[model samples]
Target: MSDELQHLKAAMESMRGELDAMKAALSRLSRVVCIDKDDDGVETVHIECTDLLVRPWSDPRHLGVHIGSSEEGSYIKLYYHGEEHAAKPAISLAMHADGEPHIQLRGKDWKARTDICIQKDHGVVAVLGTNEARGAVMRAQPGGGSVAVLHPDGQARAVLVHSEQHQFPGSETARPSTDLIFANASHDTQMKLHTDDAGSLMMVGMAGHSDGVAVTMRKDGPAIIMRGVEDASSIHLMAAKDMARVAVNQGWLAGDKAAASLAAGGFGSSIELNECDGTKRVDISAMKDSASVQLLDAAGNDSVSLSHISGSHSSLAMRGVAEHDCIRIIANKDAALMRVTGPQDNDTDITSAVYEGKPHVLVRGRNRPLVMAGEAEHGGVVCAYGLKEVTGGVASLAGGPVSGVVSVSSQDGTPLMTLDGTDHGGRLLINNDLGLQRVVLGTKDEAGFLALNNTGSNGVIACATPEGGVVSVCDPDGNVIHTMPRLKDDDDDDD
Candidate 1:
């Protein structure tokens, strides 16, 4: 029994020594200082603490980076020496409630000046200025991004967006587009510049009224539009590869569709002015080798027209009540003519033309007398023709040796009577139906004489010589057979 007791005592002593060694090791491990060696044999020291602050030992107020934890989450705060309060940090990095990270930069007043945050949608957002009055915000997302500049009232003043798909402020459907928008203090859209798959556009307006100005560039061409109101006066300008046009609308109120327009294209160019009732009032046009100006009445009938065509005459025409009743003045390379036409086929024309290498004026009408006054073969002459035919009762004045003359013709154009001035004196003549002379009265050898003829050449004559009066009769062969106031040398004389 004594041997067993000695052995138990030795065992107890050995156990006590081991237990003391374990307690010492545990006490050393309980300290925060931890030292480790990595694969590269680099020694690293780690220390754990409830809070951390970095500052100059001589100035505790001048704190730099302070790291700590709160009931919410862990955070890191940055400070500047000139801060009024140590509790307000200039910068803060923290975890958001949605398990995302957020960073905030504060101003001297401890208000957040800027914030950079990761959103729950795995996007990034940055805001500038205090939370109460944000100045600007920039957001980037998986589908798109946006930058917005805000007014002091927190209304968006301008926004720039790039998106794979987006719904515009006033649009019903979403589309893929990039847009820059400007707004007024009232949150009204003032201007917008946008681009999409189809084209690009820029718009300007005021107080949410977007009809002020618009410019667009599309696949086909470009266009611009300006308006006073939504449905009021407007001007539109458009251009395509082959054509262009400008349109002006007075207003659409009161069911008025009146408009004016100017257009140009490969075919022609035209300007149209419309009346209040939408009737075409005036038209000016230029086409291939031709140009025209036309004035129209309320009924759309032509009132006046001026036109010029290459290789053709230029004309100014004024229309009357009837469609075919018009007066026209036309000028061409060959002549200039003025024509008056009626609804019937009746027309009157006055033309000044070059004929036979001489300028001439001709006045003619349908079924009316013709008057021709021009340079004639002898000299300047005036001719008048009767109705129904040019051969009836023609009269002419010639600037030749026989200056003044009057003539009468029968229906068949046979000379009937004539009174003319000769080189010597005045004369009168009468012709038969067969164009034969029947009577002649003239000054012969400075004496007044009258002669009458029959068909067989027999005639009677009476004359007043310088001395006295005389009478003579001629036989069929034109030989004088009787004479009054017989002469002394004549055998047949009766005294």
Candidate 2:
């Protein structure tokens, strides 16, 4: 009977070992399944009936973790579905309280408890808690110290050797390394460029894992080499030596080398030339900023220049000059010459002389200079809204249209052309004691060609145009009291 009992115990032990082996096989195939917590605070990872029968849990409070690598290692996990209120935190992999939660990590030679909290400090892309969090997740090195971190956002942020600075893999490093990230500005994730003992260059954009570019300066030379791959698997290259000449979208490739190029603009559809050598040349249409040129005359006098000349419009033309050289500016087919002498002094004098508003031309009160409106002489100041007032006329303002109220008075200061005067037959003439009222038009209407009249007859010389041909002086009503010859013939010209 004793022998029978021992044999039974051994059988039970064998069964236990087989069950453990089955569990290990199943866990290797497990994946993290997200289950939405329902209104009743229950999180459920629904599975097929056949799956449940193989690895059944007590009630619904089982949350599973496949604790090993997808390729190898034993599996260990505990699941909670909501069967017990106290088991909620374990199932959710979260702490119920407002403070930090500690998780114990066990390794071959050491055990450590790490506090979990949200990671902030990283710009828009990195938040707290996720691998992408700024300073959250860490991995233990084989020798026992935490050495590297993989951001939940999918970036291998940093890797350290002992207590030394972490070497983040990037284009600037040696070959066989990749330190890159992608981000949408709206997403709370980002790829950060790091700088050690210098400044970090940060780039953020919406792109795929492979849809980015990496540019690096050649260790021994001033040139830069850029490599990139698009999400569609297309590849491209850009080589440059400086930022000033070859801008990367918005940033200029920063360097002092004689040449630069950018492999950018969506799969490097374009190349840019910044500074080039003695025999190098680039097309003018491609230059947006001032390109540096090494112009070597037989005398070796270098003068950097632009490919195109700019001006104000048809009425204005831009000109340049060497020392003691004359700059000829042609305005509306009218050319004006200026001899530039010095640096700052020449620029100011030449600019003013060439572009100054031709005031008192095109009529004194005209808002724009005739030069601006296609006149040769007057075009200088046509668009010069800011004109100073000289003596003997209404002071000009910094700008015009000059539509606001104007106080036109006698030279002796008696109000003549005032806002109160009605426009009579388009003439602002008031029948003042001096017989001189005024009509005012906008600067554009400085020609003053419209008319006005007080047609309501009140008997004290009501307003009328000479064209009416009735010279009868009448009372308020239709009664004519006196008559005068028709002022003038219809064909009579005022001029």
**What lDDT does candidate 1 reach at residue 273?**
88
Taking all chains together, each candidate's TM-score versus the true structure is 0.73, 0.20
User: 1-495, model 1: which lDDT tens digit per residue?
Assistant: 878888988888888888888888766655656888999999999877557889846576678889887767778898856445656688999875567778888877778888887665655554656554788888886578889998877889999989887776898887788999999888889899999988999999999585488999998899998877665787889999888999888773222567899999997999988877778888999999999999998887888999999998798988866666367787887677676665555556565655446667666778564777777666776667777564466666656566566676665668888788787788988888777898999985679888898984757889998778888888888788877876444664543
Model number with the top TM-score: 1
Candidate 1 colliding pairs: none
Question: Residue-pair clashes per candidate, as listed?
Answer: 0, 41
List per-prediction Cα lDDT, in the order shown.
Answer: 0.79, 0.34
For candidate 2, write residues 62-161 as lDDT tens digits: 4344232222222333333343432222311233244332233322222222333333321111123433244444433333223345455545554432
Top lDDT prediction, candidate number: 1
Report how far residue 114 has shifted in candidate 2, in Å.
8.7
Q: What is the C-alpha RMSD of each candidate to the true structure, in Å?
A: 6.2, 29.0
**Model 1 per-residue lDDT at 445:** 64
